[model samples]
Target: MEHQIDLTVEQDPSRSYRLLPEAPACGPRELTVTLRSSARDVVEIAMWSETGLLPQPRAASHHARLTIGADQIASLSARLISRWQRFVQFEPVSGSNRLREKKPYLHNANLTVRPQSELLAQVSELAREGAYLLGELLAGEERALVRFRGHLLNVLESEDLRIRFDSDLGVPWPMLAVGCERLLEGGRLTVDPFRLFLGHRHQVESTSGTYPDYWWVSDRHHAVGSANLDKDLKNVPLADDVLKLLNSRLKDLNVRHFSDKLLPDLAQPVLDEDVMYFFCHGSYEEHGGRTWHALRLSDELPIDAPLVDGYRKPHTDAAARRNSVALFHPLVVLNTCFAGAPATTGFTGLSAAFVRHGALGVLAPQIAMPQVFGAEFALRFLTCYLDEGLTAGHALLETVRWFATTYRNPLALTYGLVCGLDSRVVTSPQEGTTGS
Candidate 1:
């Protein structure tokens, strides 16, 4: 019964999904959702697929199109952030304990009355609403997801979902929960909210910025480095454990710890390391009428967008035309708040800077997170990707699901990905090796 196809065949097949005349083709295993600015308070969503979104062999081959009020999505993103921050711990429990306190409290949130149930319902409603909007191409745009997922959208059973939001506003695609309160066509219900969250259910990534040069690393060992910018978190046992894992678990390991360097030191041609970790605080500043996101390590000055762009932007067009690009594009793990869900998808944040210049992918929390969870999340992700040999996308998706199921903590959903859905660690960094 669980695998039963919950088909909601379109009453009016005319409105069903269809492929566009010139819609480009992508891999059958992949789906791309693009959100672009349309007009005031409106955004256009386009879903492209090669094998069609439905499950049947003769499924509608048309691309999906929908226009949603930008404000609605913006509100949903804010609500998701507010929900987790209020119920779950965002900052470290204590400044001194930095990374010592480790516990998953998503189920009860340490609350005796168990308000999680209500919040779960709310999150699922948000998820349902999101699906309803995205599924606007279906015959019945107003139908619940449970009635359509089995035959319409190829989700839950698959995790390869790539999203590109070219608008100024960034949506938290992973945190949106779906169908927790809905009954399927067979009258079966999925009341478990943890499993319904998009981030936990799918390997979703939001990417923007110019494509990086397809440069390769000719080295044999994968270089792993981390920066502990905050003194409070610098000496934590978690950091030590991570460093040890990078050394022992990975073959031909190259582990390094970066110091609290200033802009000049960071500006040089010395951004080397395939896997970069940062244990620091994300800072935000308003400059030139735009929010310039920055990162602070220890007491050093903030590494903001402008500073990063000066050195991080991809090679000049002329250089790129000459086939000259960074020897290796790194996968950056920023355990900082607002790093993943940037204030703007434009070149206004450090994540954007790295993606624009060169990065396999950048993973970071969309909002402020508990220090304990941040440390643990980083460890789990790196362990899965570097040691377990999972792609960056799978590593992230599995980690979030693990946390939500094992610890009842859904904070992992707060972390978002920019590019690198298929990024994975390599044993030999051959110039031809391409997993990022």
Candidate 2:
């Protein structure tokens, strides 16, 4: 049996609705409900199977219910068409992982509905059913329908969603997706899958400054008995390769391949650098009962102290004081394991400390990252951003796409971007003039 109910209550701000229909007391019972709303305004709807009819005592048994809001339907349709467009674009191209050069599909769309907790929960459930349903919804084949997955819905907060495309949809097979809850209503929203690009053009315009230079800091050596040597011994060559690549492309680039150096000395050049790349070992250590994420430096010095100090006024000589002030905010890339994990205390970790100082953003791994994949990702990311003039976020995303497609490895998703989502770093003319 099918039932329709109007859930709009004058007192409630969300314009929510609820539907209840009668069912038999015996055997198995199946009921379907269809919700209707005006097309003028986008409405978000959520539904769940209730144990009993209205005006009756509620039963303990509950089942997953189909909730379809007007806005969700429209949004799903739009996203499907956009994905299809991207798939079509990649069909003709070979050996290129770049997204088609075109305007984003969600550039002008307005999202009216706020994703409440319940709605987010439903979306989480939808993602678990595999990508077939979402693909179908995106294809615009279903107007409104419900399916019974025959399991109790596990109520868990959605952290991330993974969608895998069937073979029928060629290439770019699986996607690791995240949802943005707050968007400008009656404002433009661009559909850049994965939110990969940082739009830092405004930051550049506001400061009236040219793009910053590059600084690559690498530590290939560790103490004789250091625990990190076993895990990170292979990353030394990778770091060297990265340094060479940057030197070849960037004009005002500085490379510091250090061993047995203090934190302040190693971090001095980083104060004025525009882009800081660290290729070393990282770990989370519990010291004095407090956890900290530290990058292992060549001098066997943990970077935790410098990060704790952050950017502070120098109390020493005139030269030290003058150099203490930063000229440009850097975008730091910590190409090491566990660099992205948050510390137990205030602004902890190498990545967070850089951001706390004056960095525009930090790209680090949330867990122990494979050295091979890390090297590949770092090389491609820097190439795209420095050579191709792609934003840091976009470059990271493109590199991840290439890595994922090439190796069929989803480990790229482990790398996280913290802050500086819209920052861009371009090569300056002065640096351009003095090419290698």
Using TM-score as the measure, the top candidate is 1
**For residues 27-102, what per-residue lDDT tens digits would candidate 1 score against the true structure?**
2334555566556455444444544554433333323333346666656566656665654642224567675433
Please report how far candidate 2 places residue 214 from its true position, in Å: 20
Q: What is the C-alpha lDDT of each candidate?
A: 0.59, 0.41
Task: Give the lowest summed-lDDT range of ten residues in model 1.
Answer: 14-23
Q: In model 2, which range of ten residues has the least summed lDDT?
A: 199-208
Residue-by-residue lDDT tens digits, candidate 2, 134-242: 3332232223322222111111112122111111111111222223322223643332222321111111100111212222221111100001122334444465566
